[model samples]
Target: MTEAPAPATPAQGGEGLGDKGLSGKSLADHLREIEFDPRMIGMVAALAVIWLGFDGLSGGAFLTPRNLWNLLVQSASISVMACGMVLVIVTRNIDLSVGSMLGFVSMVVGLIQVRLLPELWGFEHPATWIVSLVAAVALGGVIGLLQGALIAWLAIPSFIVTLGGLLVWRGAAWWVTQGQTIAPMDSRFRPLGGGIEGAIGTSASWAIGWAICATIAVGSVVARRRRRRFGFSLRPLWADVAIAALGCGAVVATVMVANAYALPAGIARRLTEARGQVWPEGGLVIGHGLAVPVLLALAVGVAITFLATRLRFGRYVFAIGGNPEAAQLSGVNTRKVVMLVYGLMGALVGISACIATARLNAATNSAGALDELYVIAAAVIGGTSLAGGVGTIAGAMLGALVMQSLQSGMVLIGVDTPLQNIVVGLVLVIAVWLDGLYRKRLG
Candidate 1:
């Protein structure tokens, strides 16, 4: 028999190519070989630019510790929802009802705390707070389950289903409140939103920040050792160290600024009075500690990141998004995956409702109006592809930060509300366009 052509050796091929030609380089070879994603690097650079640009425009007011802390708090609600939203979009689906769901859940939980659970059951205690939270999650999940069932089992389009849900839930919320506001909720409930007394002490904040840094450093070392055990190629040890250092530095900076702002007005006055010193003339005085809402958002983001990057369900989500037919052929139950994704989305909506309501200290029918657009925009801006199968929880949260920063910076710099919307809409369009171009280049 005639002999087949000799295969190309590693020495004869390029850095990542192999004997079998271009197809021999797996997707992991192309992507995981890099120390970090270029997209992420670019996004970080953009954030820096925005920070500086706004700081300059606002005459140094934009980067104030107080402003940054407020920014983190304001962005927390959207960031929490964006974590779940990333999975939905990754699976090539969208939930238009998140904003409405937030409103509805807020009203339901508000009623439970303010009227229903208290007067009906004659139960008003710390336990009632737990009950209200349970009700919020349950209500959100049931709504999501209903919508998911219709879409996944009955083959209803997600857009159509969620679009209908959007209107239905908003109207339901209005009905629950009878077109009135529910306000002055429980004092214990106020901590969830991080009001004056709800924030942690400065010492606690710094301790948490350092603890995060330590955890990241340990995780990196453990991960690197595991990869070595498997004989997988690793970037230089210095690269890993550098990344860890940068992360720690960021944590330190954020915590310090928060500490600078942490000396609250009332607390500061107490300190000044005790020391018998008058407060500095026209000096900056800001709030103390990190907001509870920010901490909650961070927790959600970390949990979702672990799920999306380390779990089987997370992998299936990406598979479904990348190519549903192929994933199905490979034995993935796409319907179940889709349904679970939406259900998870519902739970996230509940968390967001709690935060939003706590922030406003009231439950109103319009509590979540137009928030859907903001959530989607945050995901898109964070580098989640609308084309599906590509996104990260961290990226989506970063996107939320960027969106909020822009809004806050513009407001500080005197941009009109109408103009702010116009600018944000433009940013969304540009982000999608950039994503398309990046994908095209990869292809």
Candidate 2:
């Protein structure tokens, strides 16, 4: 038949069909077609609702710059740990000891800085914070390594091993100085916890924001070029541009909000006096830009994202999580990767401990108490599957923010602590149930 009319070439028929299909799709279907994560969109929408609801309930106080800034700061330590938790959970492991590990590491850091280092380096020595930080991180890594070894090499279940570690580390924390609280951390170390003094100024924040925007734009171009070179599928040019624009817009908005929060007049005056500068007649409006702890948390998130997405180790971790037998048969060093993942988790806890201790200017056995619950809840809420091989650094960080927002919002509205715990428990259960449903749908 006239050679079947050349089968109505795909360009002639397929294009129209595709156009019709797209025209009939909903916004969500379009987003899915673009390969965007729907869970992320849901989380963002939920966060927005939470913020607006809390703001209304609190008479507009919750959305104020000061409260928002403090919320970011409060989320920092948990976010840092959640990044590590993503890796741990990805490989089908759990670390219940993170909170205890944090407590112990912080206690040791406090002891080193306040009691031991002062005897050797003297108080406020520049090296005190550095030495303490290094020691704490090392200790954390060692603890993690030991726990990982027991799980990987000895064939012990991770839950049992980490459970033991939880008790052991908590007791060790209490034994360190016999449950005494240490206070007034070194002057230099205090900035890590994030106070007015711990923030970068408005100019610096703007500079950083613009720099990040430039990086996002450049990265998008480079990625597109790479894909082209490989002859791989690519997103539409508009999609790429939109993604970069959204990222840059977020950075710009964050910087703007940070810069909008002016310091109290009394604090500004005292700060100026300390700097040997005269106070302005009407008082100065100094913006406490990005907080140090928040910056550190963001940096950690970036580094972990790169590690998980770009490195062979990260690939191995996911492979193991997806199918341990297959990964092992494929020549992956499953044991070593598992052990290393734990060690990395411990190191992150050390960083978190430093932030927490610095923020409170003290370390107590109770420091990081119940933190494990928060960390796990955050990772889970962020879309990390407890079953394995499903998580993202950015998602976990966002999850941490969501958890913090819930707690903060409740506290702002004067909810009782018990009620707060009940709310968090319910949220955790709901997140797990939702995750199960999402996974089932995907399957």
Candidate 3:
């Protein structure tokens, strides 16, 4: 009877079972074959749920154009720092002092602009903003270098070095202005913090969106061609097309949302008057396309993503993280890479400081208090494993958005400060737990 049994049909798991057809593979199988990161899918789904839940609880206020626009601006600084944190975590290092570093650098920049530069260049001098920014960034890099040196050259642990830095820098920040706040920053510099004047126009936003879409499409095609030329395994053409479509669609949707958020009537009227145009019977509806800080964050994300994915330095960092002894034996300059990663993290923190100071129009010793937690949480939530050698800049950026979204949503629902902290702490713990499970499954 066994010898006489019929051969297994395709439906019963024969060769054609793996074929790409309705009769063979299910949708889930097709998705699996496309090699999409399941974690990313889960994150996106979770974000959708959060948004929907918040919008419902907030009586539809959470998803409005104005709220969304403000949310993006608020998220800008955290997103910027998270980009660098991805690298720091990727190399098995931590920077507890970033928040304090941000405060110190911001205080210094504020002093230079508000109290020092005006004395020399006169009020609102064009060069004041540039000089202040450069100095702030340089100072941040120097601080990072010092801390990294202590860790790398002295063979001290990063946790100890940065923990000391956290205290030292916070005290330094207070000392910069003797616990006073610096205010009324340079006029040109204020836009970096993203008020009504900080936005690029609707036309420019659309142009940028289109350019990004074109790049995605072209890049996908080039990647596919390169894979074919090198005889590497290729994703299905349909998968590539689907990915490109989704990316372009997202860009377009974002641009549209930004363009939909209109300027305040008074601001629009004043702008028209300043331009020597008569105010129409109906107020002009000028859109706040995209904030400068948001654009800066985006640029950082793109640049960091490229650096991490396409550079020798990045490879060395990851190699060191994967196995430090092996990487050192293989001739990787592990110390140099580690030092450089921290330096880069410091530079990013500097940028975040500027954005925060500009937004508030003031800098205080507490400007970035607790921000290190947010940055680290964003990186962790975005899939930067604490075990190191596994992370993505895009994921980190998305994670920053998720973190900001939660806080913003909580605020809208009138959640207390302590509760917010508790929630954030819980989220960070859960993210790490999930990451451990993911790693274990892979192992």
What ranking of all candidate models by TM-score puts the best one first? 2, 3, 1
Q: In lDDT terms, how accurate is model 3?
A: 0.87
Between prediction 1 and prediction 3, which has the larger TM-score?
Answer: 3
- Scored against the true structure, residue 187 in model 2 reaches a CA lDDT of 91
Worst 10 residues of 1 by lDDT: 1-10
Q: lDDT score of model 2? A: 0.90
Candidates, ranked, lDDT? 2, 3, 1
Q: Give per-residue lDDT, candidate 2, residue 240.
A: 86
TM-score of 3: 0.92
Question: Which candidate leads the pack in TM-score?
Answer: 2
lDDT by residue for model 1 (1-443), tens: 01222344434535634343534545434434545766777678888999999999999999998899889999999999999999999988898999999999999989888888678666457777677777787888888888888888899999999999999999999999797889867777766776665577577888899899999999999999998898877777777898899899988888888777757567777766677887777643644777788889999999999889899999999999999999999999999989988988898888888888878888888888998999999998888887799998988999999999999999999999999999989988987888778767655
lDDT score at residue 10, model 3, on the 0-100 scale: 29
Report the C-alpha lDDT of model 2 over 26-105, residue by residue, as the tens digit: 55556666667888988888899989999999999899888889999999999999999999999999999999999999
